[model samples]
Target: MNLPKPSLRVVFLLAVLVPLIGAFLWLALTSGPLAPVPVTLTTVEMRPVTPTLFGVGTVEARYTYRIGPTYAGRVRRVEVQVGDRVEAGQLLGEMDPVDLDDRVAAADAALRRAESGVVAAHAQVGDAQARRDFAGAQVARYEQLLLSRTASEDTAEAKRQEAQVAEAGLALAVANLESAEQDLVRVRAEREALVQQRANLRLIAPVDALVVSRDAEPGSTVVAGQSVVEVIDPSHLWIDVRFDQLGAGALRADLGARIALRSLPLDTLPGEVLRIEPRSDAVTEEFRAKIAFSTLPEPLPEPLPRLGELAEVTVALEPLEPAPALPNAALHRRDGQLGVWVLDDGGPRFAAVETGARDLEGWVQIRDGLASGDRVILHSRVPLRPGRRVEIVERIPGLPR
Candidate 1:
């Protein structure tokens, strides 16, 4: 195809105009009032919001039973080992008898001897009582004979003395019987104490629990109150958490909560506030609280969490309420005012806002000066001013609209 060649003047004019046009376009985009300021925006919305408190905690059993002996002795044998499930009153281990059996036998023998003594005292009392009766009869016969002059005065007097002696003997025998009975009682008490001490040598489970630790082994010497095995009730597990005292006001018994165990990060267990401790940790400047699981995992993970396993707990202090809310990142401080830069018809404008409680998930409640469906500037490439022209590029991810 044939084409006409352009003139030199025309070519020069075209080249000059092209570059000038390009420069003009660049200037208009960079500095013109109509230029668009790239920014990230989030739409404010009203939904349910709940203020929450986060804390690092540990899983603990409310009732931990330490199995040990009441007296110092050598551990004879441990029947239950760590990780073993035990029932209340179940024997876990035993301490060496070490002459305890012998002591018990001796106590039994003493008890029998005391009983025999009582029996002998009773027989003596009976014999003395018979003698007193016979002596009294003889005294009566002598008095009658003396009255009739058939017995001498000296004989009657001797008979009366015999009766008095017999009465004294009977009283002495009765006193001996009481002493023997008291001795029997003392022996019985000693025997009972020995039996109890013997039973103490055996370690017993105080409640249904899983043995978490073994502090003493068979043949190892342990003192009184020294723990041999440690067990905890799985049903009584709870999370012990600490929060800043300033934010602990909302925490109370029966408040709902969520817990994430370090071992099971994928799972969030339902929980409720159990108690707020009266005392706080002075060094940490934290308030102590306990949270219990509302429902354990359907199929609890094998080898349940250890007694002091690390966990994270978030307590829901208040019920969900509808309110104007925005992403926490959208908030900015200018002129000592706590607020956010919102997009109006003009551009990014700073709006002073009163904020209420915020959640752990980075959503802040807008108490005033903002309404639902308002677009707030999340981030801008350059500093923004009131009425500044802006272009919304995208919505920030994970923000509530």
Candidate 2:
């Protein structure tokens, strides 16, 4: 039996509908939501990784000297300006004397008077001694005359009393002399103290240093202990760096480092870890360290690194043995698990990984859940899940080509 022939309209509708459905399916599978995610892949390789800690720091002086007056006073004159190199014991500035000179002069005068008093007392003692000797001689002569019946007993007794009075005067003169000497000593001590106070008024450099700041100028009044001139040991500059505590387990003194100053970006100065601070920043969770230059910059950078200038530091730690490792970019956290999106014949799947130390070059050591030659996704166009399909690419768009 022959089947009924379809109409021309039906034949046209059938032809259009078939190609439309085919195009929709092709678009969905190739370039639409159902398409495979594009990604960059890296292989886990066996290699040694040199863990390095990166930190930000500021230039600081190991020894900072703040020159100021010991007493509150006005600045008289400043001998050094900011950026000036100074030698040890060089005078930096002076404070106003404000009658201090007069005080010292008065003490000197008092001391001189004391010395003159001492001289006068010595003369009195000598005169009193002579009078005592004369009176004693007269007493002996009168007693001898009385024994020979040529002088009376009253005369002899009177001479004896005169001698006793002379002896008392001598004792008094000697006591006066001791008083004058003590007064002289006290006056001398006051003069020396005044002289020392005068010396303190002059601000002097304590070491060979570079003047970093001049906080006060001529005629500026400052309180005691306030800084007038600030100097630092240019040869002993260091960076006060802070690194994340999580990555500072191996940090220690004597480790080599590279320093890049914000002012001099292109220059990488060689440095080393001078010391690790005993205290850590509890709030920021960072460890503090001091990094010193292995060799100071030749001729020292013009306008030497200002105190508090920013710097970037990278410290090289101990090298690790060869182990399975991959780019840190492959790491991911899913449902509180540290893992990576690993690619296999089946497809991309999340594999929980136990990670070890990471290095500055973006490589992380894989302790478990990965092996050498395993492929992992480094960068993906979209978030991935288990059984997700991916298309490998040389590099991802929007990143460095």
Candidate 3:
């Protein structure tokens, strides 16, 4: 080669060696064994995987009631707080009963006036009827007297006129009585309506339940039927879970389930599927399913959960009696498929298997590709070969008979 400049020669030499040196140094740093990642695993066994569907939701009340005035008014007093338990018809709060009291009193007074008017009307009816009978008798007597010439013709005519006047007066009295009676009826009806409206001013619990929320404070103006206090029947409370459609396939209406409170992780409540909301929400692509607890937890051992405490719910799926299962650590990803290292006669063999359900424990249900009594490693670190000799380090004690 022609004599090259020293800088050119040095730069060319540095370019090739620098990359090789960097590659070796990077490999050396990654291959260090200072602390081997220790992975704990278990051997394959027939694990009783209670097939379960996992869904996150909150504890909810099955029966909720919002207590408010049937007639709108200002809240005078709130007897209970948000967490207070109340019974059916128990007064949760009271509204400004002054206006209501005045209304009730006015209603009572009107009713009394109406009743008096009715009595007066009845008395007028009796008087009108008696006068009518008396007038008829006098008219007949006068007519006979006139015919026998015992009474003057003018006198007979006058008696007949008096009878007609009495009849007209009776008719007027009867009409007045009917009108008074109708007025009384209407007045009494109006009074009753006021009474009902006043009674509705006292907010009461519709069912025996815990008050989940209080929407109004004293002096707050609330409308009739406006929700002021939220009450829920603790016994009828249920969980509403939004689950992916694919996850929902494993569930059914009335299927057995187990519920764990977020606070009380150790305890599980027995429940049954109440229903699956048929329609999926378009935004979330999820549907809600409900499960009703068999009974309300009494004197909740731990803290009592609120209406919307996020919870993890697992639907109790049918147990796979004879389904194959394996240690979770043995599951290895390879060539875009799942495989596991099995100790074969030739050495360590790669077995392809499909998995079904997992219990969040170390065991997972093996759906396919593994036979009974097949030996598979629990945890592996070394890159496994299709056929490589392996030694069994430990076997699980008390394997299922």
Backbone collisions counted per model = 0, 0, 2
Order of the predicted models by TM-score, top scorer first? 1, 3, 2
User: What is the per-residue lDDT of model 2 for residues 267-352, given as tens digits with 9 covering 90 to 100?
Assistant: 89999999999999999999999999899866676787778999999998999999999988889999999999977775898899
lDDT of 3 by residue, 222-282 (tens): 8878988888877777888887776467677988777887877898888888999888788
Best by TM-score: 1
**Between candidates 2 and 3, which one is better according to lDDT?**
2
Q: Which TM-score value belongs to model 3?
A: 0.74
Flag regions of model 3 displaced more than 4 Å: 1-50, 98-100, 146-158, 223-227, 299-302, 318-330, 342-345, 355-383, 392-401
Compared with the true structure, what per-residue lDDT tens digits does model 1 show for residues 146-253? 999999999999999999999999999999999999999999999999999998888889887899999988889888899999999877789899888776787789
Residue 193 lDDT, candidate 3, scale 0-100: 80
Model 2 clash pairs are none
> What are the lDDT scores of the predictions, listed in order?
0.87, 0.92, 0.75
Question: Which candidate model has the greater lDDT, 1 or 3?
Answer: 1
Off by over 4 Å in 2: 1-48, 126-167, 320-323, 326-351, 371-401
What are the TM-scores, per candidate, against the unseen true structure? 0.83, 0.72, 0.74
Per-residue lDDT value at 374 in model 2: 89
